[model samples]
Target: MAAAPTRIRAAVVGTGAIVSGSHLPALRALADRVDLVAAVDVDEERLAAFRALAAEPDETGPGFTVTGYTDLAAMLDAERPDLVLIGTPPSLHRDQTVAALRAGAWVLCEKPLCLTLAEYDEIAAAENPDGGPYASVVFQHRYGSGAVHARDLLTGGALGAPLVAHCQTTWYRDTDYYAVPWRGRWDSEGGGPSMGHGIHQMDLLLHLLGDWTEIRGMAGRLVHDVESEDVSTALVRFANGAMATVVNSVLSPDEVSRIRVDCADATVELTHLYGHTNDDWVYTPAPHTREAADRVAHWRTPAADLPSSHAAQLSVLLDAMRDGVRPPGSGPDARRTLEFIAALYKSAFTGRPVHAGEIAPGDPYYEAMHGGHPDWAPAAATAATSATAATSAKEQ
Candidate 1:
């Protein structure tokens, strides 16, 4: 008798909104390659809804059973799936991912890997061999065709050396948007625009520009009652000597997400309207002889239809799990992105430039309190708050 084809057994930890919206659909589409074995969520209602969605008949009209669990530990102990998708909130990521890896399940966690650089480092250290059953953060932007093409041009020296990059990510979030209890809280969601909305852009910038050597930034809660900043801007100097300016905000009336890279040879620009969609891109080559120009133009054909960020990322992750290889956007790669944001916050509060290695694990800011949130504020901001609290107590 012929042996059954192998399929990567899969389980998802969080069945919240994103899981139902993007992840469930994407995984179902890859049914032949992946088996949806189990799902876990604290909320029973959410778990039931997601299980029902997952168990529905496929296009071929065949139903599949997806086990549901309210307790993550129990599910892991029983299923021991090959891959685990963590779609939990930012604050819970560190603990969940560490547990998943310890259970011998490879993890594909959602973006802004954790709330702080400290959490990122902790999870990275916990991921045993740095490869399989390890963790991969979901920075879906890295999978877009435009991103792939741009990376080739930048890394292949086709665009010479990167000189400067301008990144802007703006989206509208009104009072109603903060209705969720943890929506704008420092401990729950991390920070405001910089950590939540701007993370994707920051990942793209780091992927394109290499390491950051220094950063100076400013952030504030200009438009919201949230504990974290609603707007932020930062100036970064890359290790390669290229400079960049990043702007992140949720108060913009007209939302725009774009990154323009100016290289020694030419310039490349890409923009997306929504968080997950790539709308347009422009690639310009430096002036050259007629023959050279023709060749460059021939190489630069019109942009083609590309995979959506989530789809592309999911495909690569599944492929990696099956082949026993590390995905390009591993947890370590995603850590750099989070570290950059941590530096940005530190600089914003201190009014001083922060270096790459400035926020070490032992740094006071690595574990500090802001407002009522422990270890949630930027180091400098936490110090300021502590002083104020001390003064208030003295007056009493």
Candidate 2:
């Protein structure tokens, strides 16, 4: 047998919530294959906290010895890490990812990837053409056993052609949640739930349904007093002639993250919030045929229960790194999801159905998801003012 691959040296940037809660845990779980070498954060307190957290021993092994840095460049230069985990805000993803890639380190960045298609291209440009140092988006939902099984079935005609689907990501985020300075702004957080919260479900939808052909969407600032919309809805048409409805909201009391696909032979559904296991998926056969029922018996997820999480995706990324190949969530595979998000925003703001390949280099949407629409926030403000005045008059 070939020799076991050497342990990969890894570092993390932004010791914020995502790093502490998600990425760090993932790194520790894969300790046998990776070394948590360093961490970077602007805040000294958070950096120190991360260093302490990294040193905590787990049941399987001892902890890591991670050096802390206030500057990413300093960490990159000093450590010369093989992998870099970026958990910063969406606005900073492009620059930071580019920086890591340029430093000859592979990158796995958190979702939203970047603010626009143009920025995504910039990140892609920084990669080595030979495929050693690539930047991947952290879309862990696609790595789940349920999703993998579903995508195989859907694409292989096991469930027949997907006809109609619904992708919903409705979760509550109150005033205190958006109290953070970067939570609600367009420049900081990118778009609303459509870009931030719903993108995960949307990416999973695309992963199962294949490429999307067109999108017609609408967004509104229904509840939140912020620069971005609190709720958004869209109708998407897939290249396979299937259509889907997508609803993303942060104002719903009954929170749910669900995707249901109605195929010609049967229906497959996944219902959960944030993450899901194989048990969360249901495969229902069409009542009209016995063959559909028979296939349902074989249409099952892997026996092992691997919930969709950062660890699952990170494990795959580690394998790819060992082999020196491009990994999932990199290059075109990652760009497809971000492109769909850009199209949704363009269609919502422009009030037109956006088709694939339409938002090219020069299009405003290519530069930013909002497309720099001058009327984006003003339109919502106008409606809110009108509603408030009408309510006041009725009270008088």
Candidate 3:
């Protein structure tokens, strides 16, 4: 094991709900190891709330001062923290990540790195190798016990070759949910449910299944009055020859985030929304196969009770950073998830199947997520009537 930094001076940008709910709490949990040096946001009210974090520890402990800044660059120049947690809207990710890395700070960026492949590449370019600062995107589900255990079984051949899978993130997001200026805009949030919501489930799916070869899908604004699609469905083909069906929607009343992978010998599944523990995973061995059943009985499982959270991944990230290794969520690892989304969108908007690496600079989709679809436009008001007269479903 590598020796962690004696004291990591950390700063956080964007004082939104995710920052308060997950990032600040996680940082506080590591209060002994990380110092809350600075908080940056445009809103002073949010910054005031973050200022309260400095008062968390009693006078006896490391009672440090945390400064608030409206400008990220000024904070970067002043505090120069070891880590910077970015929980801002997606549109700002690229510029902020580039600036953070340039400021010699390890970055813990939120999900959906940027709105386009071009932006993704730009962020990747900012990463300085040769023992310089790095950036890690947030895909917390991949760090959960459930996902880790299931990945081990599949890779170790305990679950046999993965044949098929289903990734679903169906959550209810009212029109008011998109009322926030940046909530549903393609330029801001990237894509709708696929980028914001299902991206977590999809990241976990890709983490286990490996690289996806190609995908064909469709996206639509079925309900929510937004610039981006309210729902999206994709048929993805993995490099291992396993195909999966992906559905992301903000219209489901009974919300559920699930990923079920069926292998030749057994079926492994996980069901959870937002986060998951080891108990959320289940194993079902192949029926009527004595050899498979016998092997399944002895299959190894994760013994620890690790829950899915920012702390889970952040702790590990800090460990790696101390050891001088690039963290998990950035670079190629997180980029793959973004690439998968890009391919799915290109396929949907262009009415054609999109192979991996198909979209690049100059590609219509590379600039914007909607890919300049001729018919698609942001809805002023959600179409209340249902469009189920016939159907608009695509299955793998």
By TM-score, rank the candidates, best first: 2, 3, 1
lDDT of 2 at 52: 93
After TM-score superposition, the amount by which residue 286's alpha carbon in candidate 2 deviates from its true location, in angstroms, is: 0.1
lDDT of 2: 0.87
TM-score of each: 0.88, 0.92, 0.90
Best-first order by lDDT: 2, 3, 1
Note the clash tally of each candidate: 1, 0, 0
Question: lDDT by residue for model 3 over 1-396, one digit each (tens)?
Answer: 234368899998998889877887778777777888899999998788778855566532434478999999999999888899999999899999999988888899898888888898988788877554778888899888777778888888777899999999999988778889999887789988899999999998999999999999998888777777889999999999999999999999999999999998778888888899888887787775446545665553577778988988988888877888878887888888988998888888888999988788766677667766655534321121112212333321
Instruction: For residues 329-353, write the lDDT of model 2, one tens digit per residue.
Output: 8888778988998898888888999
Q: Which stretches of candidate 3 lie over 4 Å from their true place?
A: 1-4, 57-64, 288-294, 297-300, 377-396
> Which candidate would rank higher by lDDT, 1 or 3?
3
* C-alpha RMSD (angstroms) for model 1: 4.9
